[model samples]
Target chain A: MAINWFKYSSPASFYSLAGKMIPLFAAAAVILLIMGLYIGFFIAPTDFQQGEAYRIIFIHVPAAWMSMFLYVVMACWAGFGLAFNTRLSSMMATAIAPTGAMFTFLALWTGSLWGKPMWGTWWVWDARLTSELILLFLYIGFMSLQAAIDDPRRADKAGAIIALVGVVNIPIIYFSVQWWNTLHQGASVSVNQAPAMASTMLMGMLIMVFASWMYSIAVILKRVRIIILERESHTTWVAELQKDGVA
Target chain B: MKPRHKKLAMIVAGVAALGVASVLVLDAFQSNLVFFFTPTQVAAKEVPIGKSFRIGGLVTEGSVQREDTSTTVYFSVTDTSHTIPVVYTGILPDLFKEGKGVVAQGKMSDRGIFKADEVLAKHDENYMPPEAAEALERAAKAQKASLSE
Candidate 1:
């Protein structure tokens, strides 16, 4: 017997399912956050070069990673929505934008904080930095373009086009150091080489990365549930949920 | 194929075409996208004379110099294959040490020197505790001594 995975593609069912799953993800996020913070601040040793100032990587690296990862995820959802004309897929894509933008902003902010002391400047127009900045702009562009359109279907289609087009920048950002003589350092944790970092520092960074992932999933799920309720407000199921005070 | 399948195929084709277009575009704009030039690039006279640019590489070991009473500092950046002399007047960043990565933005002077307006430390991705770093240094020293003996 095969399970029908498409059943949850319905907004009414997904909304309730999301509501049920939110607390679990939220709890995992909180737990991982605490553990990650403890490892980052307490267990990790001072950097031999940057000293304690380098501890900011715990937040900076994870936020940067999440920003790029979330954009790909958002674009994929938007593309699927556009291709299949699925209402739930479009709503999910819409719900992911704000969170993706938030992570992008966080990545930029935390990066500057790390850069000011280590690089002797708060900002530079290096290839990696510029590409990442363009990513932030792309996220904003997607959201604003969608909001500018009054019709939800048209907004989804337009956003999907922009999202798919912007996917090229993702590879550019990831490979900027290798492709050019960039001011930004190459990745510490790339697949082709052994990590350039110590084991403990690497562990802390990885833990924080997992924490960010959990946090993003929880927040996106909660946001999608609200979006579902708003989009399906006229449906009988939503009306019953509102009447029963379960919404 | 169904209408949905047709739509999916269309989107995939559009995305693939867009990807190929972007690759070509990026290739054409590759030179402009480079943040800095290496010492090898600059040494080959490929860089335009009298034009300001950035050169990034490792700060040559034992090449740093500073005046006792002046703010001016001199250093050499090397990519192992080539080296470029750099001069700056501002205070250096804390991480700007000899044998470390650096990027200096400036123009080549008439006397073949890089007059930097801004100097920034370009650190590697390595992050280790001081103890681990000291251990590595000690091991390197030991290997050097054995080789000499």
Candidate 2:
């Protein structure tokens, strides 16, 4: 039998399904994070140069990657919602925004912590950092713009516009190091070139990245279910579910 | 046209307009976006005098100089194509070393010396910053071609 994936596009169906998956992903995220941190700290050799301080890359790089990746995913969902007028897609976009912003802030904070010991400064107006900062603003703007609107549909439309507009910054952030003479170091792990890191370090970083990915999905799914309940509260199904004490 | 078509058209137009506007804004900010200049660019006098900027490259081999009691130190940064002498008065990061990548933030003097306010070393030992690595690769290729000829 084929799985009717499209059926879950409706908010009600996805709400229950995501509720089932959240615990699994949350557990995976926690386990992977612990393993990644352990491997990063204990198993990875001290950088002949940076010593133990380089281990911050395990968290910093993953957070930065997720920030950028989530923005694109958010924009894609927002765009889909705008085009198809789907409530669930808009909810997904909204749900992902706060998490994306959190990761972006984490990336910046960890970068500053790493920088102080290594780069000798807490912060600089480097292209990568600046664009990432702008991304934080975009997320805040999207959420605030939505909150300011009373009607859910209007808020979604407005949020979609902001999300689409901010999509330009994603490429800027990714390519900033390459396009500018930024103090920020270039990527160690890239697609075309071999990783400029030890295998164990690379493995740990990858695991952390996966862990962050799982965490984002689980959190966003949980948030979207709440969004659906709030927006669909007036519907008969929601009332019936509430009466049954399951909503 | 239908109401849905009208909304779709509005979004398309709006995104297009926003895209064009951002492109213009970013183009205006292009020069300012350069995080640092290479030693080669400094040598070519592309950098302005007394204007603070950053220069990034490898610390040229055996070029670090330090005073006996003073915190002042001098080093030369190189991309193999050109080198800029940098004078800085402070403790350098632990990673700062000869033959390693570095970026110094300062100004170029009229006499061609760089007065550095801050000296930052690259991230790690195994990591040659992408810009520094790219420059080295270019220099190596040039050397190979010259030797072959």
Tell me the spans in candidate 1 whose CA falls farther than 4 Å from its real position: A1-4, B1-33
How does chain B score by TM in each prediction? 0.79, 0.67
Q: List, in the given order, the native-contact fraction of each candidate.
A: 0.94, 0.47
Model 2, span A1-247: residue lDDT tens: 9999999998889989998999999999999999999988888776666768888999999999999999999999999999999999999999999999999999999999999988888898888899999999999999999999999999999999999999989999998877776788888888898888778888899999999999999999999989999999999878888989963
TM, every model: 0.90, 0.85
Which regions of candidate 2 fall more than 4 Å away from where they truly are? B1-33, B124-149
Clashing pairs in 2: none
DockQ scores for all predicted structures: 0.65, 0.31
Error of 1 at A19 (Å): 0.5
Q: Report how far residue B62 has shifted in candidate 2, in Å.
A: 1.1
Q: Give per-residue CA lDDT, model 1, range B36-123, as digits (tens).
A: 7889988998786889888989999999999889999999999999999999999888899999999999999988899999999999
